[model samples]
Target: MTTFEILNGAGADGDQLAGSLNDALCTAAPMVERISGMPLPSHVTVRLLDVAASQALSVVHLGLVYGMAAERLDTEEAFDLAGKLAATAGSRFRMFERITWPLQLGKILYGPTGPELVVVPAAHRAARTSTRQQTVVMGHELTHLAQLELWPDMLTAGPRLRIKAKLTGQPTKSLPVIAPLFEGHAQFVHRDLAAELCGVRARRRLPGEAAPTLRYRATDWLGAVPPLSMVRAIYDRGEKFVSAVMDAGGRSLVHGLFTDEGSLPLLPELLKPELWLARHHPVPAHNAHDQ
Candidate 1:
């Protein structure tokens, strides 16, 4: 079950928009589970935030990442030191990018019960985006919730990697692979959910339109000795590689990784998933028990 809290900013249309969001999420939530082959929280509280709350949450997220709040501090001196360094990096160096992140559509909220999902419906209204678009945003955040539930460490990969860079004085070679895997899987899942929402909304087959293809260079994604600094730019690369992996081995490859970490792609295998596929699913077969 999902309960919603609207924290201002819908104006008179608040009730109508809230109704649309509830319906959309009810339909969309299961799609996330089906695609990722993972379970979502039994109950998730969804918050619809206005700009002020959205921006405030962004700062909180950063604070949590960096251990700016004392209770979140770890025992490890290295972890805590790196977190302090991360906080400094964000506040001092990445101000503009930091400013932009809070303006996003939705995010996974960390709460006492579990990870909740939050959206800025007013962001949708201000841009005149459709319910389907807003639903897709919900799906994207929903994927993150699945990630948080199933592989919480994956969500922490970014901050940890930055800390590694701070420690080693160089970016790890795996930067290209890890960052993309984190985001790409969610991007692919949410878009698939978007298409389903569209079909459900229309109650008919989607109209044939030539969807524009997105092209990305392996170099751009793979990067030439990726610097820790390119963290923002390389995340977009994940969807293509994830799509390719799904094409090669299907959702079984995704499902396998959760239970059998051995199947998780080697850092080098991330960009070339076939290498991982050839190793893990070369037989190209799975039974009911596989999932």
Candidate 2:
């Protein structure tokens, strides 16, 4: 079992809000381990940021560190970029506070010590969601923390996909190859954790709801790189696909099958999980349903 610490800076409701999230993530941690068969880090931290600090952190910390190259920006680039984002970030801050919903609620950041999970207490200071919704969101984020533990060296689709788009000269055209699985894996574990905790599965989409996708329209000086926000949107796909894969393969998807550096799915396979399923989990037809 894994234990966690909660750091609350979300204002007056911060303690109450952080208490709920701490309870949710702490309760959900073992369930994530059970579903994935991967032991999460022995300890983790979840920080609840108020509206203002969340925006600043998003502008500076996320802006500087996330890029295609394994190496981060040099000092000159970091300072210059930081300044530009800070200047324009006023507009973006309003957007995050008013518009963005759950993505603004929870995310994981890595640093010298280890992975850190930070989240907003509410959509804004004035609005706080129900306890259950907070648990669902925390479960999703906790799964991400588990993913980080399982695949310590793995980078998500955003950076590598961006660099590939640049090289191929097809930013808008290329499909994000790794996103479905990488995100799907987290979503599957998260949703399953939700099911276990709540006794209801949110697997089906309501009528007319669009299937989630990673839309890739190029922008900024770097045409290939997706803006910070869209990075979160892309991972919302593959919950169903992951469920199908796990169903066909076994009770729980093999965390290693996807996490293993040597045997990870290729580009086409990620786009169509069926291809990945067939390649990695070659179940006999008669036994397919049973698995």
Candidate 3:
């Protein structure tokens, strides 16, 4: 059985809020496993961040964290590669004008110490408070926790090594390929759980909801990628890709992609919705959203 610890930073009502979140997690965990075909971690931590803390961390993430890590490269080759990436990122950042920190409801992050799921209370409170929303968000973050647990390397060496290799202009083996699959599969699980528990389709026809026509350019700097639109595209497009896979081959296929890198779909293949539908029989439960 998995256990969760909540580190609430909201001051007043923090404990009470943590309790609510804990209950939400408890209720959602089984559904997450059922939908994702993955097990939850034996132990997990959830952190609650108020708006100010969320903003401050976002600053650190974009500026000092990535930038300083880039500066610590031992080799001249790595330094030069980091510089080039920084230049490209800087130009993109300028055009976007501080798009790095969008108002997010929650995020799963790993630090030097360990991995934790962080949620913005202000943002979550602003949304319509419903059992469905709570279940979906909890299910989503829990799916991330499960991914990190299953791929312990992703938590331990994968991120730092991936960054260093990219900074040194070396080959990045799986992070870029694995990332969308990770998020897409999480999104699939979240939606599936939402449908089962809440009796509603999680997909929404919001702005920027259109599927991608072309594949995203492969880059090691996905973490530092500046375009908010492009970032949104990655999640949106990735979710659709996971949905197609689930529709075609069910949860097991999506789970296989996570557990085995070789089973993962290529970026171009994910971009083509028509191909997925033509080849694989769609899952009836998953296809209910269209009707």
lDDT of 1 by residue, 167-208 (tens): 567756644345567667788788777666664422112446
All candidates: CA RMSD (Å) = 7.8, 8.5, 10.0
The residue-by-residue lDDT of candidate 3 on 43-148, one tens digit each, is: 7777777766765554334343344444455566655554555555446544442332223556775543466677766555444234446667888888988887
Global lDDT scores for all candidate models? 0.60, 0.59, 0.61
Which residue pairs of candidate 1 clash?
none
How accurate locally is residue 31 in candidate 1, as Cα lDDT from 0 to 100?
A: 85
Top-lDDT structure, candidate number: 3
Misplaced by over 4 Å in model 3 are 13-16, 58-103, 155-176, 203-229, 262-264, 273-291
Error of 3 at 193 (Å): 0.9
Best by TM-score: 1
Give the local distance difference test score of model 2.
0.59
Candidate 1 Cα deviation (angstroms), residue 240: 1.7
Per-prediction tally of clashes = 0, 0, 0
Error of 3 at 160 (Å): 6.6
Residue-wise lDDT of candidate 2 within 62-166, one digit each (tens)?
443343232333345534544444445445655754444333567676533556787776542233345555666677777777777767645433443344444
